[model samples]
Target: MGLNLRAAILHNVTDNDQGQLQDTIVDAISSGEEKMLPGLGVLFEIIWQNSSEADKKEMLETLEQGLKR
Candidate 1:
């Protein structure tokens, strides 16, 4: 099979604590590297899958607001 970026990102960070995860996210965003986007998308996908409908709505609202800025 071909390399799975999402699976690789998940495996690499599976053991990360909350602080480590936060740092990783902050660093990824601050770096502004296009290559890091897939990893962030994987993280967001995991979050979306686990989130409740209300939580998803709130996230979508927040995303919309951010986009408008």
Candidate 2:
């Protein structure tokens, strides 16, 4: 299969501004459809790659706390 999900996702979001990106995340999460997970994961991957060590640690802590709920 020649399908590259990451490239496709990035292409779709290439022109998105901050507000548009926020809406994309909010919509995907609020909808809670299983299909949205891959997109969310791709977004997270981008975020993770760009984040600093401290930011990554904070995100991990926040995720850990949320998972306990």
Candidate 3:
């Protein structure tokens, strides 16, 4: 189920705008909805796996801001 969802997200995200898609996913995770949290570990792992130091920093910052909201 996770792999399937991830694949679908990847496809859908890449099909339109890459940057906004990335932000949307990150925002979803940061929101920490009950349903959103189930696969969050995987998403976090994937983000850290693919992100550079700067990107990771930005992601963390974004997460912090989201938490405040």
Candidate 4:
């Protein structure tokens, strides 16, 4: 059977509270493991999908500014 990684990642975190989700994200980023990126991308995809147009524009601007550094 093919594993649906995005679905699996979402399922694992579906019941998490805000603090738990924050901790999970912090831990993954702090670990600096390349393996964690796909999971983070999945989470970002969800955030992007749910965000308003203004919110997305803000995010993009912030991302662009950060990339210039």
Model 1 agreement with the true structure over 22-46: per-residue lDDT tens digits:
9999999999999999999999999
C-alpha root-mean-square deviation, each candidate = 0.9, 0.8, 5.2, 0.6
lDDT accuracy of residue 1 in candidate 2: 75
Q: What is the C-alpha lDDT of each candidate?
A: 0.96, 0.96, 0.71, 0.96
Stretches of candidate 2 off by over 4 Å are: none
Candidate 3 is scored at a TM of 0.45
C-alpha-based local distance difference test score of model 3: 0.71
In model 2, how large is the Cα lDDT of residue 32?
92
Residue 20 CA displacement from its true place in model 1, Å: 0.5
Candidate 2, after superposition: displacement of residue 14 in Å? 1.0
Error of 2 at 4 (Å): 0.9
Clashes of each: 0, 0, 0, 0
Residue-wise C-alpha lDDT for candidate 2, range 1-69, written one tens digit per residue: 799988999999989999999999999999999998999999999999999999999999999999999
Better of 1 and 4 by TM-score: 4
